[model samples]
Target: MDRKLNRELVKATALRSGYSFTKLAQEVSVSTESVSKWMSGETNPRPGKAIKLGKVLGLSYEQMFGVRDRTLEPQVAFRLVRNQDPSEEHHERAREMGRMYEDLVPFLPFNQFEAPPRLKSPTADYEYLDELCGSLRREMGLEADVPVSLPSIFNHLSDKLQAVVIPVFWGHRKNKAELAAHIYSRKTKTTWIPFNLDTKLWDARFWAAHELAHVYTFDVLDDEAGEIFSDAFAGTLVFPVPIARAAYEELAKVRLKTQKFNLIVEFAKRMHVSPICVAKQVDRYAVAKKQPPVNAEYDGIYAAISRMSKREKTVAEEFFGGEEPSVGQLLEAAANIFKSPFFDTLSKYLKTNGGSPSFIQGLLDCSLVDAKALNSELA
Candidate 1:
């Protein structure tokens, strides 16, 4: 279905929230003309801005579009690609999955975990975040210059923060939203994060790090600054400033663009992260050090990383084969590889409460047939 902004709903909600068009635009960092256009249905804001606008007007994305999912608890944080927003069907499916997780949390062994300390007075300052990440690296017993082990990172989230990190096969499509649903269930007082496992290993590592940052700083983050902090935190956590400085020193010696590209690719390969992560961290290091930023074509660097990632198998592919995996196999991958107890706990709950396979289908984004197999396996 062709979806457009619900102009009447936007206008009504904004008015109820005590916002004039100019005030609404100012609140969301858009112009009065743009707000008028959105209200007139002449244009629609990008997904990020639309969500921002909804937040300012006290509406959800679905509410602004006249199709609210009342079952979905308010989201603490979520990340989407710049150009692609989840379609309504995809959005609702994700929300339903999140609700299922929430329903099972009461039966899960959630109390064994503790929440991480929140950042006080969060800022997007490079040096401040760099230092914060440095402290976190040391606290986590990670060597500053070494590549962070992916399993170690996953275990940290599970053991330290009490977060349920569910890895689902979201498909290998361009412009797909990475973190579809990251909700903080008030009833359970737990955070449920489901990220795409379809991304390559390196990219998946970065995304996992990104979720870690979000869990760390959720209490202090807004939509915009939260993303900035999460990006910086993820980059610095995986490729810290010490490593960035070393890479920068090598990059400074190179004059050719190809040389700079090669140096970045090499650094990324060494760190086992995306070249984009490497490049951004290098830029942050340069800014903090008060030095001229290295010159590199970011698009070329990103394209190269994409090509390299294509060769590396995604988390799903690594665990299950290329064909569709049975629910039992998927759960095994989640439990073993992700180090997540979500399915194990849910299986216990299902045994007592007697739930349906459709819930499993929604949670794993798998077919009903696969979900039925999970019920049978549980039986």
Candidate 2:
């Protein structure tokens, strides 16, 4: 390959790896100047150094030279708050997971489906956003006002939208609150949304809706406003305007502010959403209805809910009989795809090399013992 092409590939891989040039240079046993030159297309590494660099970036020698192999390229969209900063490690891990998904896709049973058209503008009106969600719900044969079933939504997305909804256990625990991610591959025309399973069921469902909003409107929104729009769209999708208004009105009838706490809990349970989400939705409903805001009282209600000792298990847990699906479930869902000779060859290679356990552990974020168990299960 030409020096310029090699440079571009190196830069792309480095960005995906979330590694600085100096750090990558140290890993490859090259000087910072040499790495800079390689990136700038002024110099090319020796064959031995190039091989080492490829290994560090998890790329094959051909891939390092800008050759197009069968690997998939995934574009990731994170659903994080504006103020939060994701560490480089987080970025790299996300990319790594994307690559893993890419490898698994060819084995999965995927249908070709197109996502909804992107909104023309990032600041689409609330009514328009609401209509979008309603349209989607109707398309999926769901009632606009009813609480959505998570598993049902997952199946619809997988079957009709050609999207995969997977619960990932790999992200940083501290960032679990804001760790939803959507990965879209233009080449494969598929989408993957992974929610952090560590969160409450209500929050997980909300995050799922948020990621779906992104999938529907990603091309139209600017980076900053996309998050805001997706948040609004998700809340509206999970709790429609009419339902939210009725909920707020019911709570408003409670004469004492303190008495409304129980009503809030009941409303949340009925809506299948967290109390915090209900509180925020109530605020939004109030704003839309031109009613006086109940911010202070809702804060108190939230605090009271937090003080409770035991909380109810999420709807998902109850529906699944307290057994949450894991990476094994995902693999099983794509079982037919893995029956290919490629996987058979790879499995044999790993087993012969005694690398099966470590590979499984790393890929699924399991401990060594768990990985060994998984290997046995697969065998």
Candidate 3:
């Protein structure tokens, strides 16, 4: 990241991508003058600032600064799949990562499960996905145009789908350098995990939407044959095919930023998906459209209706909305009223394992060996 290249990448990407420094400033929530200073290399960008530029410019710290291994000293950041608990600096990083996830890689499958089956196979379990999707469509009364937040979409399907959302960071604790939100299926909906405490408002919102795509879009399609079907369905439902196509056309003219960054922002706006998902979709669309530098991976996102909706609504009111409830507040809430294990299993699991549970009891409220032993294998 020599001074020369940093300036070149920023200016070229901006001009080619058809973006203004003002837009960059807006993306990072800073002033245009600051962007100017960074472009001129007049002053070093703060760690937080540098990360933003890197994301927007499609470069890394080492690639952006002539200096390698530049120190990152941001007060806060929110990333995908990094920290279990975020520091304020880390939280901001996480949000930044969320923006990337929402805008770029948004539709990429968050498969906590094994890959779906291939097509034309007798093993294809189309019923589950179809029932789940149909149930949601019925429950929400969603027209093709309904613009529900991702979480609301999940809440709508939680109970019947039997799953919940959890946020994860791969390497860091709470920094935006790397964090991701995941949806997990469970016997009891209450047993799902949650986003990190320090996640940003917008990130939380998009995570909800992306997860909802999973809940809704995977139902009617054959995902196992190839992930492309479910991935496309999620993108289509969450973002709508027409809008995304239009946005893609607009972005194609820009050459300043890599298609990675351009598609990330443009498609995210069109469909309101997370940046990461947008990136994933861009990859899928590229391949489907016969392009390169994109991966065509898909995971399914379908579920039952009656249960998911209720639980999701509670999460929207509580965690995402930032309201604290008394134990009684939670207790009085009917078990069946919301998704089975979301709020409860979420609270309990996050408190203990922070999500990576190995035990079935820990993941679901089911008796594993004990139930079987007592039923038939009794001595």
Candidate 4:
């Protein structure tokens, strides 16, 4: 029929500028009824009418078009270029999140089996990610036993990976936390949240673990789904085939023996992931293996992202609070997170030092890095 526009803000935007539905319709050459339907999301707008309406409503084609920002935004697509270094502020925030990764790596329940469905990268670049983190729990064989060392762990992948640390701020004009909470990048090589939320050390690791799983999704699938596949990747990483099977077998025996494995807690201790993730992993394996999902009795899950409170550190949880709101956003935050001057300086230092130092150490060499807060405090 006609083009769609911002239904909620249509009257406000139109009224503010002495515009109205009739005027909008005239601009787009559509009937008033048609314009009403489009506003209610009942029907999509035709490209032509949609473009015309956008101007009348004082909106850009992108907003009027209603495309997901991460999926269709030009800059998001540009991130695929892999030339921009993640902002230091963002990286420092990520480093805070990295603490969680470091804590969980040690306890990760490596399955190394249940071979994940492999997909090859279609090209040198693809965007693979999504918001479903529970899926990552099952795939990674996390078993709640993993620990992530932000400083040392990420040092290994600096070459092949393009890690971005987005610092989330709260009560800081714009809420960056929401943006940082979800991620979008094209390299498929890797996008590191290094630091996210503030539940505990393990929680941060869980976020890191999830993003690390993203690295694999890009590597194997060779396409760009953003966070959608990230869930699958994280599930695979935490639950891997071997561990899933082992958990199932163990649970089966537990059922038979009328015993309690406390699988959730046990896995958490072992994998450094949250007990909640463990429970979900169990359920995933059970369902995938043709068994009943984990019982509802085991439904309560611990929040892995709550680690920030444990440290009494205000940095990670402030997904919206920051000195410079712009710098705290994802790509920009990474450059400033480690207290570095910016990516260029860090890159230069890495080039001089052979990119061998840990992420924190490298930050020390760069100028303008908030070394004190980023050091042992957040590190």
Output the number of the lDDT-best candidate.
Answer: 1
- State model 1's lDDT: 0.73
Candidate 3 lDDT over 295-325, as tens digits, reads 3122221122123223333232544354643
Summarize candidate 4's per-residue lDDT along 249-302 as a digit string, tens digits: 666656522243365455556665555555666666676557765451342233
List lDDT for all candidates, in order: 0.73, 0.63, 0.42, 0.43
Colliding pairs, model 1: none
Off by over 4 Å in 3: 1-140, 143-146, 164-236, 258-267, 290-379
Indicate the residue-level lDDT of 297 in model 2: 44
Candidates 2 and 4 compared by TM-score, better number: 2
Give a tens-digit lDDT track for model 1, residues 217-282. 775777678878887788888998889899889988888778888898888889988777788888
lDDT by residue (tens digit), candidate 2, 45-72:
6545676787898877667665544355
How accurate locally is residue 179 in candidate 1, as Cα lDDT from 0 to 100?
A: 47
Question: Quick one: best TM-score, which candidate?
Answer: 1
In order of lDDT, best first, we have 1, 2, 4, 3
- Tell me each candidate's RMSD, in Å, in order: 10.3, 8.9, 19.4, 15.2
TM-score of each: 0.75, 0.66, 0.35, 0.42
Model 4 clashing-pair count? 118
